[model samples]
Target chain A: MYKLELKRLIKSRSTLFLAAAMLGMSVFFACVTVAGAGSMESRGYITLRGMEAIEYQRGLFAEVEGYVTTERLEEMSDYSVWARDTYGRADNMPRDVYERWISYEPILSGSCGRMSCEADEYYAERRAALARLAPSEAAIASALALNWRVDEPFYWEYGFGGSEAGVNWTLCLFALCLFCTVIAVPAFSQGYSCGADGILRCARLGRGKLARAKILAVYSVCGALYLLSAALFCAVILLTFGPDGSSAQLKLGAFVLLDMSMTGVLALCVLSGLITMLASVSFTLWLSSLLPNGVHVLALSAVMLALPSFVNAYMSYPACDWLRLLLPTGSTGLQIGMYNELAAYRFLTLGPAAIWTPFAALAVPALEAPAFALLARRAYVRHEGA
Target chain B: MNIEIQNLTKKFGKKTAVDSVSLTLTPGVWGLIGANGAGKTTLMRMLVGILTPTSGRVLCDGADTREMGEAWRDMLGYLPQSFGYYPEFSVADYLDYMAALKGLEKKAARRKIAELCEILSLTRVYKNKIKKLSGGTQRRVGIAQAMLNDPRVLILDEPTSGLDPGERVRFRNLLSEFARGRIVLISTHIVSDVEYIAAENAVMKAGRIIDAGTTAELLRAVEGRVFTARIPERELERAESAVRVVSLKNEGGGETLVRYVAEGPLLPGSDFAEPRLEDLYLWLFRDERRQDDV
Candidate 1:
């Protein structure tokens, strides 16, 4: 049955198309990650603007300039003369004197070391100094940088950069499984919705064997998708960023990405995929059983995913939280969070309606889910033969 | 072990597709003949437990199919109209997969797949993708999958629809070969497909079984009403208005041969003839136009 399911899945156009599309996307994402291009990272594009600021800072001595002092001139506190000497390579200068005058503050504090630095370094030091004066602005800027994971591109680019392909892979599998469930509606639902396959199933061994086969086939498709997606995500992440990136690593993007392990991120991705895919498949199966049309399942899933966010946004407080919780999309947040190794610490509290609910409401005769059982039963009953 | 339906009724909203239809049968080829909206398909689906009938019982080998669980399905085979497939899978792969779904053990499934492939003439295209197969071959694939478990009961709705003459003959022969110890319930618009294999036939209309007997018995019921006549195209409408015209053939030179059903007294120019299942079927279903069913 397993082998047969594999072959059958390979035969289906939608599944095949899904796999192909995933492969193509993985390859593209892998190549992009390999290129080490930062444009794809996130909300910010650092370019010629920083260079303009660098050029302007050259005119300042104590122009209250932003440039960090790379070096200083002793006799003349004029950085213009020092800049000329340094261009000739701040060569063999007196380290103590150079350091003292550059950090010196003419109005308030005594100067410290360091006169000139490169554009990035200059900005870094300037922020540090300004932080001493006004902590709010400096703190906000730093927080923003940390949020975007931009501090270290080596970690972000290498670690999470390559992870895009894998994420896409996992996402595609969820999509494929969702697709199989919905598609089965048209093929399997009629067995009962139209009652076409009943005669054959009843007269022969089809009552059990045929049903088992359909289930086996469905899961086989799901398993294949899951395995493939996992492999793709892992492979892309490894090749681009190196396998070690799955652990804690620095990253650079809009802001600076600080401490995070690669393992935690992968765990999150897998958990998200699992929750979404399972929910999708189950919903599809259930819908196929009841509805003659399969589109209803897809639509239901879409609404499930979208409604909670919409309601949470408009209602201010949770309006249909229970109803939303009934949906896979709503339930997935807890599922994903709990499954993730890093984020597993998140605690959950079930509200009033949830507390008194009977476990039987969640229990189904087979697979314990309406979608899975409905589809399987429908497919079995609707078997067409002769 | 056989199939038995007791007081089985299925409804959709206010309309009934099958109303308290019941029957008991052992293994053999049984032909279900019906008008377009007869409850044949509906009754078949209910028996298989796919569609839960509003009220009644469907039993297979004393095991009520509704609660038969998964075991009963293992021995059943089905082929619906317009079946679909992955298209990417090779013929062999598709068959093998279906064989597994039928619950065949690996070793047995493999052997069964080979046997069915050869039986269905699918061996040559075993490596070919289903999408690449011709319509006839696709239908053949459908038949083979139904036979994977050597099901005790088989239901085929319009199985020979797209076959060429040669393929149809072969398919009919194949069906006859497998009829032993198995109940083959077939419903088709084409009478000829079941003519050679069916031991008994049924005529259905308006969710009811109006006739059930041997083919000869059914044809005998309508014999006195049949006649063949050649008339000018201009008289076609007049002749049609007089009785139920079952078939019309162009005889060239603007002349036509019209075969029709009438209760008594063939017109002087027309000739009396034996009835056919096709003619009987048309007469039964065309009752709406006939305005009276006795």
Candidate 2:
């Protein structure tokens, strides 16, 4: 039975295609990791000169009225009015930048400081659900960026509209899904695509044992690739951009959350990979059993898998919004932002600006695994023969 | 134990494929000869539980095959006219899979695979992918897999269709050896192949077994309905229209030797003669509705 399953798996066109795809993706993943790590330093982000330098500059001034001196207050007041006036400006030096530059002092800002950041755990769940385009993904998702190479930190905090970091994060997700789907589509179509049904159907316990083996083998093959790609990309982004919050920063917006344990993100990858594999295999199995030709299985499964993504195209449409929530790709349609509740900003409370990441990722796979298992059995044994 | 077909009937929508067909087949090689669309494949498929008959009892050693799942199929082996398998797999891998499906334990499976491969001369190509093998070799592989379990009953449909002469003889010899104490119903359109191997020949035409018996017995039954006539080539068509023309051979100008079927003489010297298997098949198949047999 083992031999039969192995033979059936080996003979399958989908399996071979998946193997080749994994190898290529693994290499691409490694490159993405390397590039991300290598380029992390030069990425778009600004680091404050230093608290020491700013503090030294502040020391030169005299203080009064439990605030700064009257003159220092005047200087701070001058900048505050300019920021307020140009709040909606889109200039290179927009108020958004000015806002970040002149945050309040811990005691004087009237907002919570490091002490407030301590309670950030309250909003952490929502923050962890952030989804945005990773810079690496956005860098390649568009045709204008045709010459743009894949970079590191392949994933972003939010999968859709936010800051430059947020947009890239969301786009990156769309890109990765497109890539992962190539592998998943073939895995599902393998049985019919390869014409190995006879061997599978004839084996002892062929209906039951061979199917389990197939699902395992396909998942193992695809999972290995996904891991290699994800790990390599993360390494590249992290290594290239030093560990400072700016380089490969993982900030979340207010309510959309991700991993509090950090392990959640990694678990997400492994889990999604397994789910995609089962869904693909099961769908393919169903197609092979029902359709006379494997091409139909491949074409139809690809369409069915991809059709759900159209919901993300129209952001403002209410129906599209609902559709996106139901789409398998919707979770990744988020954006992440950092709400600095701290004075020096050593820590950031992460959140998705307007999306749900953790939940969507988990839900997509939950719907796919069992569906594929049933389909695989049908495909492996359904007969049109005498 | 024997499989009894009790007035078994199969209807395809409205057209009956097998109608009121009853027979008792025990352990031996039974040759089923019929023309195209004669319900040969349908009958065989039903016997092995692949196709369901409209109303029939496919008993396996007294057990209904439909009612009994694994227990019935455990003893059944079938090879359809066209069978497909994964082409990239080596013959051994495919057989192992078949073994698993047949519920054979690993040890027994290995032993059976080896034995069948040896019998079918598949040992040389046992490790080769099926796609790379020749047509005849592939057919043998199908046969080998069918026999892997040493099944109590085997239904082989057109088993020798793709085989070369030597392989066919070898297959026939092998089947005969195994059929000594097992039921093997081999379906074929060709009469000669089974004429030599079958203990009993079953003739089917228009979805019914018009005649069945030992080779000599069937030949004797059709003796008087068959005859040969030499006449002008143009007039031969007339004789053909009047009688079932089995064969035609041109002897000279405007003259042809024609063998045909008749209830009595159509021409002055058109006497009845001995009938071959082909003649019987034609006489039965010539007109399905016309059952004017003497």
Candidate 3:
């Protein structure tokens, strides 16, 4: 039964079309990221862009791919001051000078700032900022404790650009959410829309077992689509930019408090994305079971999936923020999503207790997936045909 | 096997669709005859357990069908009045899907599907999508799905509506052979579809079962009242308005043969005709037909 249900869904032209669109979107975003990649050099006024720039930056960072010791930091700082004094701006420096000096500027700048590079001053300032910005004292303490896990002498590497760009591209996740909505909104409602429910519900196993089969098949299809798209997006980006910074610390590029490598961050992002996709699909299935037809389910699910973006854009109240963060598609929004939440020091406070936004985002959808799936099954089984 | 409908009633807002209807069904081919909106479709839907009744319950073997749940559904088969199918599904795919839902094993399902396809004359179009089939062929597919499980109780609504006379004859034969020891309830306005095959018949009007019995027994009400008379062609319209005209056959030379129902012979040289189930149906739903004409 499950096999037949899966086959039925796969046979749908709309499902096939949307799946192709999703994969195309994934590759398109990857290509866009790669096309936009470029690096500036001052070697007799020669500038590199695209894959050329990426390779140039990769080679420059390869030589410095070790722990950021005091000597390296001082040497970088000395070069930065010399280049600024001589050229007045790095872009005005000679190509050889820019290649030798400024090409390594990103590594130097991120590690040397008070916001990151210096451990004691960074943490102290961070704590004060946390106390000021954190929703509660518990949040401040949580952020401080989590910050301690950031690997000291931050490991510098050359390949994080692709992984970072792939994971942080909000449009990729948004498109995926919409595709999943289009796929799942008709899971149950199609029966009603086509008038098949009257006959199906009369079958021996049609009510409960068929509902279960539909739910499982929809989840399997949508989940596989998500994994495939994410993999393809990562593959395109990583292949273009070269996979060399899998072990590099995220701290080198983003203001993330988690002590995780670039690969670890990518995994977290993908895992959170998969969970959010399932949760959103499950919610749509529940709506499918309740609505009379697929059109209504599609309209309502689309609105729901897009609501968080609008709320985050126009609203600032605590309740509005909570609503934005708690929605099933909350982690896939453009303004506030899993990637942004992971890098920001935001927290959701509940009286004295506080939880990190990334943790809350992952947890909410993880719980909602199974809960909504159960609700969807119940609603389907109990449905009375028109 | 037995299906007992006890005081079943269904209402949509202020309109009553199926009102306090009670009947018991046993193993045999039974016909439910009614006009449009006479509640035959609504009653069939309730018997299939897809629509909940506002009051009362249906019992299968003395146990409430609601409580029987899947166990009761396992013994039942239903073909709705107008059903829809996935446009992508081929006739074979649809039958296989329904077979699986009926809890038939894959091997059994394959065998049953092949047999039903052959029996229903759908073997040639087995691979064709259902949407592309003719209306009569689609109705056969619906019938095939309903009987795939060899259910103990089968309910078909308007099973022969779109079928040609030949196809309708085949369907009637199939149902008669299949219902030897099973309960088959067929609801249709075309009384003749079940007139010959139905072991018993029920007549519905205004959400109630106005009459039910064997064809011979139910015909007793209209017996001796059904008559055939020769009238002038110009008087045909007057005769139709003056009495319940079951049928009108025009003869040569400005003469028309009219079969009608009335208390006594109202026309010159009118002879009493044999009352069939259709005569009883026309007699019971004459008021509904009058309203339809208005």
Which candidate leads in lDDT?
3
Tell me, by TM-score, which candidate is best.
Answer: 3
- Model 2 - which docking category? acceptable
DockQ, per model, reads 0.23, 0.31, 0.85
Total clashes in model 3, counting residue pairs 3 or more apart in sequence or in different chains: 3
State the lDDT of candidate 3 residue by residue for B194-223, as single tens digits.
Answer: 897999988888888888888888989998
Rank order (by TM-score, best first): 3, 2, 1
Worst 10 residues of 3 chain B by lDDT: B285-294
Tens digits of lDDT, candidate 1, B141-238? 88888888887888887899888898889889988989987899998878877788898887777777777888898888778888888889998888
Show model 1 residue runs off by greater than 4 Å: A10-327, A330-386, B69-71, B106-120, B228-236, B247-259, B269-272, B289-294
Which regions of candidate 2 are displaced past 4 Å?
A11-14, A26-213, A223-250, A257-263, A315-357, A378-382, B6-22, B53-55, B206-221, B229-242, B247-258, B265-274, B288-294
Model 2, A1-386: lDDT tens per residue? Answer: 44455556556676566556554554454344333321111113333232332332233211211322324334444454465576533233443444332432211122112113322232232122221222222321221232123122212221101122223323343344444444444333444445444433433354556566656654555456556655554454334332222112222322222212123333344455444444544555555556655466657756655554544343545445435434433344223111111101111112322222334345554685566556655655545342
Per model, the share of native interface contacts recovered reads 0.28, 0.36, 0.91
- lDDT, candidate 3, equals 0.82
The ten-residue window of minimal lDDT in model 2 chain A covers A340-349
Misplaced by over 4 Å in model 3 are A41-44, A112-120, A162-168, A244-255, B289-294
Highest DockQ against the true fold, candidate: 3
